[model samples]
Target chain A: MTAENQSFQPKLSDSPLVVGNHRLSSRLIVGTGRYDTMEQMRASLEQSGSDCVTVAVRRERLYDRNGQNILDFIDLDRYTLLPNTAGCYNAKDAIRAAKLGREILRTLGNPGADWVKLEVLGDSRTLLPDPTETVVACEELVAEGFGVLCYTSDCPVTAQRLKAVGAASVMPAGSPIGSGQGLLNPNNLRIILEYLKEDDPEYPVIVDAGVGTASDVSAAFELGADGVLLNTAIAHARDPIRMSRAMQYAAMAGRDAFLAGRIPRRLYGAASSPSEGVISSRPYGTLGKGDQGNSQSGEG
Target chain B: MVEITVNGQAVNLPRPMTLEEVLKRVDVPPNYLAVEVNAEVIPREEHSSHSIGNGDELEVVTLVGGG
Candidate 1:
């Protein structure tokens, strides 16, 4: 549709979405990592206005010195838990973690837990997604009846491949994971969103990483992203709560602007002057003296 | 031989020793402050494994109760 001619309609509903029976009210998903304390994390989560938060699942049960379980603080009823395979390096390891996540959720009585933030990295330095292994893991997880959320490269082709492999949602990283670079390739993200929409209008595309500021989140939404997956942006912020609120507003503003159909950027500036006018150059102070440019208060 | 100082104790080890080797040799508690190697924070899961070479300055910064 042409930018000006197309009708503006909010495609997303105000209601919640049932992902494998877990209803999420907000599209934004926050992470519970890197926070200095539980109070800070809670405040940030509240400010981001997320309906869900992610947690990493390890093989063994762990407890702090106070014998407090890490999972104890998360109020599952208020927010849906998205267990991620953050440390997994390959398809097998990610899938293993996914299974463990499912089991934990099931034990907690969340049987229809199918959503996972799949991360299979090639190295620790860049934390770049290995497309080959990521696709493999996604295909397997989808086959296992899980709604796979593939955290993948920003490359449009890579995103398309993930969608083809039965990914419920394609989460393309804005930059390197956790670098907080903030929209390194906005043009590429825009292209990815356009490509995905053209292929399957119903497919959800979320901007998942390297978002450092509220403006970065807004840029993602302006490109017509379905939602955002944020962690470091809030966790590492100097004032996480304030940053969270800004992020929330940024997401909403960006979504609204996208729905408003932003005007295309023009290469050349266009003049909007009268076709025929006697353009005259007057001295700066004398221009307002005559009838042509007289002010309402003309005593002087 | 490489000179490595961990938790204020100087020790001798071969060059190119992995962090796992150093942790195994040191008497610092596993629950000590987060490990910082040359000012870069390394997650605990990586401490058991991940290699490092000589001239690498590693510091374990733990979180303490302080308002």
Candidate 2:
């Protein structure tokens, strides 16, 4: 007799998301902000099962000796710190922030020093990316030898432009940052994927921000997205740890579902069983909702 | 004492000192921090060798929580 079936491997987002020189098997990049406590943030990070986390560079307080640093809570050995220019509203400030972030990460001897998440906001109110400033920053960062992962609104043209400007990965926002709206326009995301991955299928396109729930992540993956980067949804949830776990599973499920492939939608019903068998005379009563006009047959 | 600008505030320093000595004024540990003097970043290894003169603007930054 053969050995008891023990060769099964659990399904997850195992296919690595290769962005620039960084490769993450988890495929979910989380942020280290908006948590009520550092302890909660640490626990959520553990539960999130993400290998990459983003942080911002800010002036280190001089006199306040409370002894609380984000690095103290994070395990630098386990997590790749992707420094972000989150609050910078212009290209010059954004570039300066990126350099500072990279220097800190480099001093820590982490590999993530090579890449930066470039976010140049147009305004503080909407928190949207300034297309002009963003492009300028991407070009400058790339020239400076930093792998730039740009965050922009869900605009296909901007996505293409970022790629054209040598961004390591183009991360388009699903909606406004922290609004919890979730992938507001998946069609735009699809078109972005098509544009960026046209000939270069392996080029990574990560959907960043405004992920309200786990379903939004699954929907993005099902729509052919390579990865998703979200912060507020998990950090600000009622139970952040559990919500982070849900997000991890959602990413895995979505990626697996995409790899497993989905069925094509048809306006007409297609029977699984043979039509000639005529099971129970087709049950011809008032058809169920959405089954109204799908009973018809023929196709070329 | 000579005055120097740090993180947008004017502070009095005992005298001209190395960038490393300038960073010692902060209460936070300098483990993962970067220093900038007059808009030029001073590499961590050179902090002890580079000098911070009077009126030099400095910025000491570290990692913070952000999305």
Candidate 3:
């Protein structure tokens, strides 16, 4: 029987997204950046319904009149903090950033913050991930006992290599960071997904960048990606709160549609109604109630 | 007087002190800050005993906003 005719429930939807040792119900991971205000960030996060949020580590304010820290605005119980090595340009710097992130999280009484989103950019022009450095850093971070979520290009070989090198999750970008290109090469992404899932169906593959709108996020889910990591798409939207809500529903709908199994395409049309059940009709020359003129005359 | 760098900024103190005392003098909240002395991470429990000498480089990092 076709999937549409089946009545089985989609177990994948009920299963939580497992990254490293942590299980999250919401697959959408949002970033705490580019928002106009901390309130907006908090509200958008709530609207997105994401359980994990990524934060960067930097020097603390020695003295501040505003008396504001990102941690103060975020509710620790609601979101799992995932620190990222965003500004690091090489493996050494990325490792240092990850270590600093771990220390910061530990100081905050969150010892489970060992999960680091390792991003080592090649250069400032393209902002593409340096695959070689990323692998090196991933291996070292994994050996150091950090749950390494290595961000890489949408190349199947690189994704496979990162996974083989002890990366808990493989995150490939749809395009350059913050470019809003929206899955520039979907076929490549599909290949990566297929290659990774070939060995382990439950291997976590997250699309980490180049998401432009709600549909972009939905498309990622429909392509069988495990999750999406986005910042500019929502944070830079004209109405961030509404966009966040849209993304939440879009991700869920896409996952459901993928699990339900889409119908195959065909070259010819197939009638939905019974072709033999039509009432008896006269020749084409005969006119009906609404057909004042010969319908066949249009063929002339 | 002894000088050491905190977050890349040179700071002078009358004498060498522990990581805990430097953090206090710099107004960094002990609970929200992490101390790395000379590129080595000092655990939270050892911050009190990790002594800071002259010309020591310390990197004090805290959680910030990111994507």
Provide the lDDT at B14 for model 2: 80
Give the interface RMSD of each candidate. 12.1, 1.4, 1.7
> A1-300, model 3: which lDDT tens digit per residue?
987769766556457889998898899999998888888888999999999999887774633346667777888877888999997889998998898888878767664477999999998988999999999999999999999988899998999999999999999999888999999999999999999899799999999999999899989999999999999889999999999999999889878877787868855444454434449765885544553422232222
What is the C-alpha DockQ of each candidate?
0.03, 0.78, 0.72
Q: Specify the CAPRI tier of model 2.
A: medium
- Per-candidate TM-scores read 0.69, 0.90, 0.89
Q: Indicate which candidate wins on lDDT.
A: 2
| List of clashing residue pairs for candidate 2 | none
Q: Provide backbone clash counts, one per model.
A: 3, 0, 0
The list of candidate 1 runs beyond 4 A from truth reads A1-23, A266-300, B1-67
Candidate 3 regions with alpha-carbon error over 4 angstroms:
A1-13, A60-65, A279-300
Indicate the residue-level lDDT of A85 in model 2.
Answer: 96
Q: What is the C-alpha lDDT of each candidate?
A: 0.72, 0.89, 0.85
Candidate number that wins on TM-score, 1 or 2: 2
**Chain B TM for prediction 1:** 0.63
lDDT for model 1, on a 0 to 1 scale? 0.72
The prediction achieving the highest DockQ against the true structure is 2
